[model samples]
Target: MKKTITATLILISSCLLAQPVPDSPAYEHELQIGLAGVSSQSIYLGGKSQNRIFPAIDYQYKRFYFQAGDIGFNLIDSKDWEIDFGMGVNLVGDTDRGDSRLLKDLPNLSLPVSGFISAQYKSKMGLFKVKHDYEINNKHNGNSSSISYAAPIFKGQWLIMPKISYEHHSQEVVNYFYGVNTVDATLSLPAYQTGAVNNIQLSVLGLREINEKWSFVGNIQNEFYGDEISNSPIVEDDQRLSVFAGFLYKFF
Candidate 1:
């Protein structure tokens, strides 16, 4: 969500505009709001899939940028490359087993807000980016790094982008979400800790410019967990996927 936020912002600034804004700090970057529906795994321990509607936002001024729930500033910029420091929140939602015996006794975990540094490069073929985020004010003390590529296909008023990404989660992050601590472990669940480099993803995004005031968007994303995550006793599956579609009206 956060990466796409920035990608859309880049699309707006570079592709949508006929001229680039100079390095003037005084600019009115308008607020862009869009409605979207996102679906994905309910929990990292391999729970059922869940879907919800969320608002997407993206705006930029000078070197500072804000998108979705992330905020950041570019520290380096070339004609086609940039490095930025950004922050986003982690929503470690609650868990209820209900009738699912697979999640019988897994204690609920709290997700904390996180900060990350990201680098990006845009080429005629595609856009490449790398990001690493660390948890703040939480028991999860590790970080995750993601490397992704996005290819843009432009046809008249329609824009399509396909993306692939690989993510690596540190040991602390894996354990915090999927491990069975001694206190929470039962006879069937043994205390365990996971390893690193645990997630891979692929996605495609579509956008239709509805005149100059509105744009329609749709996205499909899939994820496959590595051994560290799939091998967990609490995990039931190794793959997760999501689809999102929405519309945005430009006010400025």
Candidate 2:
């Protein structure tokens, strides 16, 4: 169940804006409970495709919010611009179970908790956002940054959003997660050093409102990795694809 929850959370964080946010005054403090499913390709060598189903929860209370397993607070709330700070789990280390037989002897990587600051701008063209996260759990002691743009389209009771983003992971993060250090080196896996990794992702998010109390949400995304990560000893693919779908019920 840990793996399923981790996968669901990863998808939620990657498609942060994909989840439907009700604008009604009645939903000011909403509790959303749902069941979600994820199908994704792994980058690790010998890693098979992962498909899992899991339950999800989200809640919003004024400036404080909890989405999936992430807890955050809005430090600045405004009409055109907003800034927030909070802590959440990183996507990589947590989900990597080293499922490959080749990686059976590797040291287990623990999930890293990170503190993040995010800034967002809403304009006629689209919604633009920039966010930075630094590991605070003394895991990799690394940091990452991402910038994205999303445009929302409304058609009747359905809302669609297309998004594009670029994310950069610090060298420490790449090395810790993908690099084959002396301690992890095996006869079959040679020691490998890594640098900063960058990724480009495209996503489409959709929501269909069933009623004031219920909605259907879904997202599809493709992420392409940079050479830094793809060239790692344990990595086999340069890209990953993920899909998610769920239903959320709003409770006041």
Candidate 3:
């Protein structure tokens, strides 16, 4: 897997260098910031649940974007094929009285330091993207990687994207947060173990250009995981869904 990731990154770097440079200013920069709150019934970790609020900032320099606060580093560029790198923090809440059915068993699991690196090629017909990510902390260590494709459903208004992903985690990472320990195991509690997860997702995003400065964006994503990972006692349902709506402010 490491070899594959290295090779893919090398190929992307080569392609980036082969493309002709744009004539525009190479040193130009921009900055933008926003705040957002997300409410969900459940974010499953073994048997834990949490609700979260995230505040975010975005800064761009020519072809790179910095994401901090809520979302981490997310870089995108149009001159050649688009490439992205992302890094962020992950927080999980106490499970005692949470809203999700999946989090009823475990309590208080937090995994910090989450991030990804990705690249894409876009054309009028469609776009193809590949990404790799990691989640690191004292208690947990996991990685995820994926490839996806997107096509315009209504030109400037909507898009449909499909993706296939794989995820793996260390035993400590998995067991600390998602598994039942020996003590709990003796009591017949289900344990979440370290393993690989394979899944597919379909996402749809819609955009509304409100004015020159602000725009509204909405998105929905649905995912289905493969049996090996999805069938675990610690695993939630095989299917997962997410919806988000947000406003973007662009500075010229």
Best by lDDT: 2
Candidate 3 local Cα displacement, residue 199, angstroms: 1.6
* Between candidates 1 and 2, the lDDT winner: 2
Q: In candidate 1, how many Å is residue 221 off?
A: 0.6
Best by TM-score: 2
User: What is the C-alpha lDDT profile of model 1 across 20-92, one tens digit per residue?
Assistant: 1222233557555677665555434435555555566667777787765567887998878779887765422
Considering TM-score, which of the candidate structures 1 and 2 is the better prediction for this target? 2
lDDT of 1 at 214: 79
TM-score of decoy 1: 0.80
The predicted structure with the larger TM-score, 1 or 3, is 1
TM-score of candidate 3 to 2 decimals: 0.65
In order, the Cα lDDT scores of the candidates are 0.63, 0.79, 0.47
Clashing residue pairs for model 3: 47-103, 47-106, 48-103, 179-192
Give candidate 3 regions above 4 Å deviation: 1-27, 33-56, 68-80, 90-107, 154-177, 186-188
lDDT string for model 3 (2-59, tens) is: 3222222221121111122122244466554444333233324343222233333456
After TM-score superposition, the amount by which residue 64's alpha carbon in candidate 3 deviates from its true location, in angstroms, is 4.2
lDDT of 2 by residue, 115-151 (tens): 9999988788878999999999998999999999999
